[model samples]
Target: MNHAPASVWKNPVHFLAFGLGSGAVPKAPGTFGTLAAIPFFLLMQPLAWHWYALILVLSFVVGIYLCGKTSEDMGVHDHGGIVWDEFVGYWITMFFAPAGWLWICIGFVLFRFFDIIKPWPIGWVDKQVHGGLGIMLDDVLAGFMALACLQLLAYFF
Candidate 1:
Protein backbone atom coordinates (compact mmCIF):
# COMPACT_ATOMS: atom_id res chain seq x y z
CA MET A 1 0.00 0.00 0.00
CA ASN A 2 2.16 2.79 -1.23
CA HIS A 3 0.56 6.10 -0.37
CA ALA A 4 2.12 8.53 -2.77
CA PRO A 5 2.87 11.95 -1.33
CA ALA A 6 1.15 15.21 -2.26
CA SER A 7 4.09 16.24 -4.42
CA VAL A 8 3.61 13.17 -6.55
CA TRP A 9 0.09 14.32 -7.34
CA LYS A 10 1.54 17.42 -8.96
CA ASN A 11 2.59 15.37 -11.95
CA PRO A 12 -0.16 15.13 -14.56
CA VAL A 13 0.81 11.53 -15.21
CA HIS A 14 0.48 10.68 -11.57
CA PHE A 15 -2.80 12.50 -11.21
CA LEU A 16 -4.42 10.71 -14.11
CA ALA A 17 -2.76 7.41 -13.43
CA PHE A 18 -4.08 7.58 -9.93
CA GLY A 19 -7.62 7.81 -11.29
CA LEU A 20 -8.08 11.52 -10.45
CA GLY A 21 -7.10 10.84 -6.83
CA SER A 22 -9.57 8.06 -6.22
CA GLY A 23 -6.55 5.77 -6.12
CA ALA A 24 -5.19 7.75 -3.21
CA VAL A 25 -7.76 6.20 -0.94
CA PRO A 26 -6.03 4.21 1.78
CA LYS A 27 -8.22 1.16 1.32
CA ALA A 28 -9.41 -0.70 -1.75
CA PRO A 29 -8.08 1.92 -4.13
CA GLY A 30 -8.69 -0.31 -7.09
CA THR A 31 -12.31 -0.70 -6.09
CA PHE A 32 -12.63 3.04 -5.70
CA GLY A 33 -10.96 3.53 -9.04
CA THR A 34 -13.49 1.20 -10.68
CA LEU A 35 -16.32 3.07 -8.95
CA ALA A 36 -14.96 6.33 -10.27
CA ALA A 37 -15.16 4.87 -13.75
CA ILE A 38 -18.92 4.26 -13.57
CA PRO A 39 -19.97 7.84 -14.28
CA PHE A 40 -17.60 8.06 -17.24
CA PHE A 41 -19.03 4.81 -18.55
CA LEU A 42 -22.54 6.25 -18.22
CA LEU A 43 -21.49 9.39 -20.01
CA MET A 44 -19.91 7.50 -22.90
CA GLN A 45 -22.62 4.86 -23.16
CA PRO A 46 -24.36 6.67 -25.99
CA LEU A 47 -21.37 6.79 -28.32
CA ALA A 48 -21.26 4.47 -31.30
CA TRP A 49 -19.45 1.23 -30.53
CA HIS A 50 -16.51 2.10 -32.73
CA TRP A 51 -16.05 5.47 -31.08
CA TYR A 52 -16.29 3.93 -27.66
CA ALA A 53 -13.73 1.35 -28.68
CA LEU A 54 -11.44 4.04 -30.00
CA ILE A 55 -11.54 5.88 -26.71
CA LEU A 56 -10.97 2.69 -24.78
CA VAL A 57 -7.96 1.88 -26.92
CA LEU A 58 -6.60 5.36 -26.50
CA SER A 59 -7.04 5.17 -22.76
CA PHE A 60 -5.12 1.90 -22.61
CA VAL A 61 -2.33 3.26 -24.77
CA VAL A 62 -1.95 6.37 -22.66
CA GLY A 63 -2.26 4.36 -19.48
CA ILE A 64 0.87 2.42 -20.35
CA TYR A 65 2.92 5.58 -20.27
CA LEU A 66 1.09 7.26 -17.44
CA CYS A 67 1.22 4.21 -15.22
CA GLY A 68 4.86 3.58 -15.99
CA LYS A 69 5.98 7.11 -15.27
CA THR A 70 3.98 7.28 -12.09
CA SER A 71 5.34 3.96 -10.94
CA GLU A 72 8.86 5.20 -11.57
CA ASP A 73 8.14 8.34 -9.61
CA MET A 74 6.61 6.40 -6.73
CA GLY A 75 9.50 3.91 -6.70
CA VAL A 76 7.05 1.03 -6.67
CA HIS A 77 6.13 -1.39 -9.40
CA ASP A 78 2.39 -1.41 -10.02
CA HIS A 79 1.68 0.34 -6.78
CA GLY A 80 -1.84 -0.01 -5.49
CA GLY A 81 -2.36 3.74 -5.79
CA ILE A 82 -1.80 3.63 -9.52
CA VAL A 83 -5.24 2.57 -10.66
CA TRP A 84 -5.78 4.05 -14.10
CA ASP A 85 -5.72 0.44 -15.17
CA GLU A 86 -8.81 -0.16 -13.09
CA PHE A 87 -10.59 2.80 -14.66
CA VAL A 88 -9.87 1.55 -18.14
CA GLY A 89 -10.56 -2.04 -17.16
CA TYR A 90 -14.02 -1.24 -15.82
CA TRP A 91 -14.82 0.80 -18.90
CA ILE A 92 -13.85 -2.11 -21.06
CA THR A 93 -16.02 -4.38 -18.96
CA MET A 94 -18.96 -2.09 -19.49
CA PHE A 95 -18.55 -1.81 -23.22
CA PHE A 96 -21.82 -2.83 -24.88
CA ALA A 97 -23.19 -3.65 -21.47
CA PRO A 98 -26.93 -3.99 -21.30
CA ALA A 99 -28.77 -0.88 -20.17
CA GLY A 100 -29.61 -0.88 -16.49
CA TRP A 101 -28.08 -0.57 -13.02
CA LEU A 102 -28.33 -4.32 -12.62
CA TRP A 103 -26.01 -4.94 -15.53
CA ILE A 104 -23.74 -2.17 -14.38
CA CYS A 105 -23.53 -3.73 -10.94
CA ILE A 106 -22.91 -7.09 -12.50
CA GLY A 107 -20.07 -5.76 -14.60
CA PHE A 108 -18.52 -4.14 -11.55
CA VAL A 109 -18.68 -7.34 -9.52
CA LEU A 110 -17.35 -9.50 -12.31
CA PHE A 111 -14.47 -7.15 -13.07
CA ARG A 112 -13.44 -6.89 -9.44
CA PHE A 113 -13.69 -10.60 -8.97
CA PHE A 114 -11.53 -11.38 -11.96
CA ASP A 115 -9.10 -8.63 -11.09
CA ILE A 116 -8.66 -9.65 -7.48
CA ILE A 117 -8.68 -13.33 -8.13
CA LYS A 118 -6.54 -13.08 -11.28
CA PRO A 119 -7.61 -16.49 -12.51
CA TRP A 120 -5.59 -18.41 -15.13
CA PRO A 121 -4.23 -16.22 -17.91
CA ILE A 122 -4.77 -13.05 -16.02
CA GLY A 123 -2.61 -14.38 -13.22
CA TRP A 124 -0.15 -15.69 -15.74
CA VAL A 125 0.20 -12.31 -17.37
CA ASP A 126 0.62 -10.58 -14.04
CA LYS A 127 3.57 -12.78 -13.23
CA GLN A 128 5.22 -12.93 -16.65
CA VAL A 129 4.99 -9.22 -17.50
CA HIS A 130 6.73 -6.20 -16.04
CA GLY A 131 6.75 -2.39 -16.10
CA GLY A 132 3.78 -0.35 -17.35
CA LEU A 133 2.47 -3.01 -19.66
CA GLY A 134 2.46 -5.39 -16.74
CA ILE A 135 0.47 -3.05 -14.57
CA MET A 136 -2.19 -2.71 -17.22
CA LEU A 137 -2.32 -6.18 -18.73
CA ASP A 138 -3.86 -8.09 -15.85
CA ASP A 139 -6.69 -5.63 -15.51
CA VAL A 140 -7.18 -5.58 -19.25
CA LEU A 141 -7.58 -9.34 -19.21
CA ALA A 142 -9.91 -9.06 -16.22
CA GLY A 143 -12.02 -6.60 -18.18
CA PHE A 144 -12.19 -9.01 -21.08
CA MET A 145 -13.28 -11.79 -18.78
CA ALA A 146 -15.97 -9.62 -17.29
CA LEU A 147 -17.11 -8.39 -20.68
CA ALA A 148 -17.42 -11.96 -21.95
CA CYS A 149 -19.51 -12.92 -18.95
CA LEU A 150 -21.69 -9.84 -19.27
CA GLN A 151 -22.32 -10.46 -22.96
CA LEU A 152 -23.19 -14.07 -22.31
CA LEU A 153 -25.64 -13.08 -19.59
CA ALA A 154 -27.27 -10.56 -21.88
CA TYR A 155 -27.61 -13.16 -24.59
CA PHE A 156 -29.15 -15.72 -22.27
CA PHE A 157 -31.62 -13.49 -20.44
Candidate 2:
Protein backbone atom coordinates (compact mmCIF):
# COMPACT_ATOMS: atom_id res chain seq x y z
CA MET A 1 0.00 0.00 0.00
CA ASN A 2 2.98 2.24 0.60
CA HIS A 3 0.84 4.39 2.89
CA ALA A 4 -1.26 5.93 0.13
CA PRO A 5 -3.81 8.35 1.63
CA ALA A 6 -7.51 7.47 1.79
CA SER A 7 -8.39 10.37 -0.50
CA VAL A 8 -6.67 8.72 -3.43
CA TRP A 9 -8.98 5.76 -3.03
CA LYS A 10 -12.16 7.66 -3.91
CA ASN A 11 -14.37 7.47 -6.99
CA PRO A 12 -12.97 7.06 -10.50
CA VAL A 13 -9.78 8.56 -9.18
CA HIS A 14 -9.01 5.31 -7.42
CA PHE A 15 -9.53 3.17 -10.47
CA LEU A 16 -7.56 5.70 -12.46
CA ALA A 17 -5.20 5.99 -9.53
CA PHE A 18 -4.60 2.31 -9.24
CA GLY A 19 -4.71 1.83 -12.95
CA LEU A 20 -7.78 -0.03 -11.81
CA GLY A 21 -5.05 -1.93 -9.94
CA SER A 22 -4.30 -3.68 -13.17
CA GLY A 23 -0.76 -2.59 -12.49
CA ALA A 24 -0.86 -4.67 -9.36
CA VAL A 25 -1.28 -7.83 -11.41
CA PRO A 26 1.62 -10.17 -10.85
CA LYS A 27 2.64 -10.29 -14.49
CA ALA A 28 2.49 -7.99 -17.48
CA PRO A 29 0.57 -5.07 -15.99
CA GLY A 30 1.46 -2.79 -18.88
CA THR A 31 -0.05 -5.21 -21.35
CA PHE A 32 -3.23 -5.35 -19.32
CA GLY A 33 -3.43 -1.58 -19.27
CA THR A 34 -3.16 -1.41 -23.05
CA LEU A 35 -5.70 -4.19 -23.39
CA ALA A 36 -8.14 -2.13 -21.32
CA ALA A 37 -7.96 0.58 -23.94
CA ILE A 38 -9.47 -1.68 -26.60
CA PRO A 39 -12.94 -1.76 -25.11
CA PHE A 40 -13.00 2.00 -24.82
CA PHE A 41 -11.86 2.29 -28.41
CA LEU A 42 -14.62 -0.07 -29.51
CA LEU A 43 -17.20 2.09 -27.81
CA MET A 44 -16.07 5.06 -29.84
CA GLN A 45 -17.01 3.32 -33.07
CA PRO A 46 -18.18 5.14 -36.20
CA LEU A 47 -16.41 8.35 -35.36
CA ALA A 48 -14.20 9.99 -37.97
CA TRP A 49 -10.51 9.12 -37.94
CA HIS A 50 -9.70 12.60 -36.76
CA TRP A 51 -12.09 12.13 -33.87
CA TYR A 52 -10.25 9.03 -32.80
CA ALA A 53 -6.98 10.86 -33.17
CA LEU A 54 -8.35 13.69 -31.07
CA ILE A 55 -9.39 11.28 -28.36
CA LEU A 56 -5.90 9.78 -28.32
CA VAL A 57 -4.33 13.23 -28.27
CA LEU A 58 -6.53 14.31 -25.40
CA SER A 59 -5.81 11.11 -23.53
CA PHE A 60 -2.06 11.71 -23.84
CA VAL A 61 -2.56 15.21 -22.45
CA VAL A 62 -4.66 13.95 -19.56
CA GLY A 63 -2.34 11.03 -18.93
CA ILE A 64 0.48 13.42 -18.21
CA TYR A 65 -1.37 14.79 -15.21
CA LEU A 66 -2.98 11.57 -14.03
CA CYS A 67 0.30 9.65 -14.16
CA GLY A 68 2.16 12.34 -12.27
CA LYS A 69 -0.57 12.64 -9.66
CA THR A 70 -0.97 8.92 -9.27
CA SER A 71 2.79 8.46 -8.98
CA GLU A 72 2.95 11.23 -6.40
CA ASP A 73 0.12 9.60 -4.46
CA MET A 74 1.79 6.22 -4.61
CA GLY A 75 5.12 7.77 -3.57
CA VAL A 76 6.94 5.97 -6.36
CA HIS A 77 8.59 7.87 -9.17
CA ASP A 78 6.72 5.65 -11.65
CA HIS A 79 4.49 3.12 -10.04
CA GLY A 80 4.04 0.18 -12.38
CA GLY A 81 0.35 0.57 -11.51
CA ILE A 82 0.16 3.99 -13.11
CA VAL A 83 -0.33 2.93 -16.72
CA TRP A 84 -2.57 5.50 -18.41
CA ASP A 85 0.47 6.44 -20.42
CA GLU A 86 0.69 2.93 -21.82
CA PHE A 87 -3.00 3.01 -22.66
CA VAL A 88 -2.66 6.25 -24.57
CA GLY A 89 0.55 5.12 -26.22
CA TYR A 90 -1.03 1.86 -27.34
CA TRP A 91 -4.04 3.77 -28.60
CA ILE A 92 -1.67 5.76 -30.77
CA THR A 93 -0.18 2.49 -32.02
CA MET A 94 -3.59 1.44 -33.29
CA PHE A 95 -4.22 4.70 -35.12
CA PHE A 96 -3.11 3.43 -38.51
CA ALA A 97 -4.60 -0.01 -38.08
CA PRO A 98 -7.75 -0.54 -40.06
CA ALA A 99 -10.90 -0.79 -37.95
CA GLY A 100 -11.43 -4.51 -37.48
CA TRP A 101 -10.90 -7.22 -34.92
CA LEU A 102 -8.00 -8.68 -36.84
CA TRP A 103 -6.20 -5.38 -36.91
CA ILE A 104 -7.01 -4.86 -33.28
CA CYS A 105 -5.45 -8.17 -32.38
CA ILE A 106 -2.41 -7.37 -34.42
CA GLY A 107 -2.03 -3.98 -32.84
CA PHE A 108 -2.52 -5.35 -29.37
CA VAL A 109 -0.03 -8.17 -29.74
CA LEU A 110 2.61 -6.21 -31.57
CA PHE A 111 2.38 -3.23 -29.27
CA ARG A 112 2.77 -5.42 -26.25
CA PHE A 113 5.66 -7.23 -27.85
CA PHE A 114 7.57 -4.08 -28.60
CA ASP A 115 6.71 -2.53 -25.26
CA ILE A 116 7.92 -5.54 -23.38
CA ILE A 117 11.03 -6.10 -25.41
CA LYS A 118 11.92 -2.40 -25.59
CA PRO A 119 14.32 -2.82 -28.49
CA TRP A 120 16.83 -0.17 -29.53
CA PRO A 121 15.76 3.43 -29.03
CA ILE A 122 12.75 2.46 -26.98
CA GLY A 123 14.96 0.53 -24.60
CA TRP A 124 17.30 3.47 -24.50
CA VAL A 125 14.57 5.85 -23.44
CA ASP A 126 13.21 3.52 -20.79
CA LYS A 127 16.58 2.94 -19.13
CA GLN A 128 18.05 6.43 -19.34
CA VAL A 129 15.05 8.58 -18.38
CA HIS A 130 13.10 9.39 -15.23
CA GLY A 131 9.66 10.54 -14.02
CA GLY A 132 6.27 10.53 -15.75
CA LEU A 133 7.78 11.63 -19.01
CA GLY A 134 10.05 8.59 -18.95
CA ILE A 135 7.17 6.30 -18.19
CA MET A 136 5.17 7.68 -21.11
CA LEU A 137 7.96 8.38 -23.54
CA ASP A 138 9.29 4.84 -23.73
CA ASP A 139 5.81 3.54 -24.44
CA VAL A 140 5.43 6.21 -27.06
CA LEU A 141 8.59 5.00 -28.76
CA ALA A 142 7.36 1.44 -28.49
CA GLY A 143 4.14 2.53 -30.17
CA PHE A 144 6.13 4.16 -32.93
CA MET A 145 7.99 0.94 -33.54
CA ALA A 146 4.80 -1.09 -33.55
CA LEU A 147 3.12 1.41 -35.83
CA ALA A 148 6.05 1.40 -38.21
CA CYS A 149 6.10 -2.36 -38.45
CA LEU A 150 2.34 -2.60 -38.92
CA GLN A 151 2.33 0.12 -41.52
CA LEU A 152 5.18 -1.53 -43.35
CA LEU A 153 3.32 -4.81 -43.40
CA ALA A 154 0.22 -3.04 -44.64
CA TYR A 155 2.16 -1.40 -47.41
CA PHE A 156 3.64 -4.67 -48.65
CA PHE A 157 0.45 -6.63 -48.38
Name the runs in model 1 displaced over 4 angstroms. Answer: none
What are the lDDT figures for the candidates, one per model? 0.92, 0.73
Per-residue lDDT of candidate 1, residues 8-91 (tens digit):
468788899999998999889999999999999999999999999999999999999999888888788999988999999999
For model 2, the stretches where C-alpha displacement exceeds 4 angstroms are 1-11
Candidate 2 residue lDDT tens string, 16-110: 74456555555667777787778876776467889988897787766767776767666677666667777777777777677788878888888
**Which residue pairs of candidate 2 clash?**
none
Model 1: colliding residue pairs: none
Candidate with the greatest lDDT versus the true structure: 1
| TM agreement with the true structure for every prediction | 0.97, 0.83
Report lDDT (Cα) of residue 110, candidate 1: 98
